[model samples]
Target: MAHPSFSLSRRLRLSLVSLSLLACGAAWAQQAPSSATAPAPTPSGHMLAEIQVIPRPAGTADDRYKHVDAAIAVIQASGLRYEVHGLGTVVEGPPEKVWPLLQAVHQATLEAGAERTLSIIKVSSGAQAGGPRVEDLVRKFRN
Candidate 1:
């Protein structure tokens, strides 16, 4: 017979794992294309997205900047126009290109030894009434 505490801990772990899988499924659904063919580009032929990929290593307090820089390297090599902000990175490009690039960023962090990764993303269509541009958004309030 197992201890009650051990059984409870195991159940909690299972619940957490199930929730994580569900979250991943939801993220994939959001990024997935609606049709088999490529998506139509906006009038400006581009879109803007702000993505923050946070990787939490399981143990110890150590330097995580290396993981961040690794992910940034992947972004830099993608050839898309991007701005690295203090909190997140803003990338502008067609949806076909940007979505894969974001996936690459998350993968890079995991390959760099992140136990688990979380990506927070915001996307805006260029056809929207007031779309975002890195320059306009960043420079508007500058001195």
Candidate 2:
């Protein structure tokens, strides 16, 4: 038979091991779920508007060309696309950042002689992974 002191020590060790395991489990439970571990909420995708600028009172072809070139340069710096669709340029970026930039661009263009305010056409944000992009269903499908 085990000595009483030895039995007590063994019981303490087992209790310590069990407590350690429980503590570790609690820590893991408290951690926020990551993309790889959690299910996404949205499935397809979201939309962003691309503002089209048409400088009406450009005064001359050179002024119009300059306005378009300046807009393209801003879009390029912002890491967006510049697509030609007959009338104006189409660029893409996150709405939160892009919309404000679009407004600035529109304001600048108008001050430079544009007759009308910029027109924004809805465009899909394509797809992204995790975060707000997760709200986009298309991103989920891509994954």
Candidate 3:
């Protein structure tokens, strides 16, 4: 007759080994290097958002100027980036604050004659070596 305790011990050992292997595989998968197209990190250690407004009817030179100026004013007033053409804007702060700001900007741009609004969430490169940083604009404007 086999010992019941021995059987139980064997089962427990097998379970532990199986669990460890699964855990290791998961960790390895997560640690693998991501492709360039992989998602970027947000400014708040979360996902980032990029908003772009393309003018509707493709306004004239003066119209373009006015539209951009109005949008810029709103962005400046909101204390966000006026330009996010490159690595994109970096809005770092609490989500509570950032969420509202993003929403407000979205609404405001749409109202400013934008045919469509493009919003992207990704990581900020934060300027680059020997290049301008997102903070530069703030410093330049002294805001």
Q: What total of clashing residue pairs does each candidate reach?
A: 0, 6, 4
Residue 65 Cα positional deviation in candidate 1, in Å, after optimal superposition: 1.3
User: Clashing residue pairs in candidate 2, if any?
Assistant: 43-137, 43-138, 44-137, 44-138, 45-137, 45-138
Pick by TM-score: 1 or 2, better one: 1
Ranking, TM-score, top scorer first: 1, 2, 3
Q: TM per model?
A: 0.61, 0.43, 0.39
Model 3: how far residue 35 lies from native, Å: 30
* Deviation of model 2 at 15, angstroms: 79
Q: Please list the C-alpha lDDT of all candidates, in the order they appear.
A: 0.63, 0.47, 0.42
Which portions of model 1 miss their true places by more than 4 Å?
Answer: 1-43, 58-63, 127-131
Candidate 3, poorest ten consecutive residues by summed lDDT: 14-23
Between candidates 2 and 3, the one scoring higher on TM-score is: 2
Write model 2 residue lDDT over 1-143, tens digit each, in one string: 76775577544432221122122234434555567655444333333344555544433465535554555556667765444434444544455666766777666666655565444443445457322221232222234
Ranking by lDDT: 1, 2, 3
Judging by lDDT, tell me the better candidate of 2 and 3: 2
lDDT of 3 at 79: 58
- Poorest 10 consecutive residues by lDDT, candidate 1: 14-23
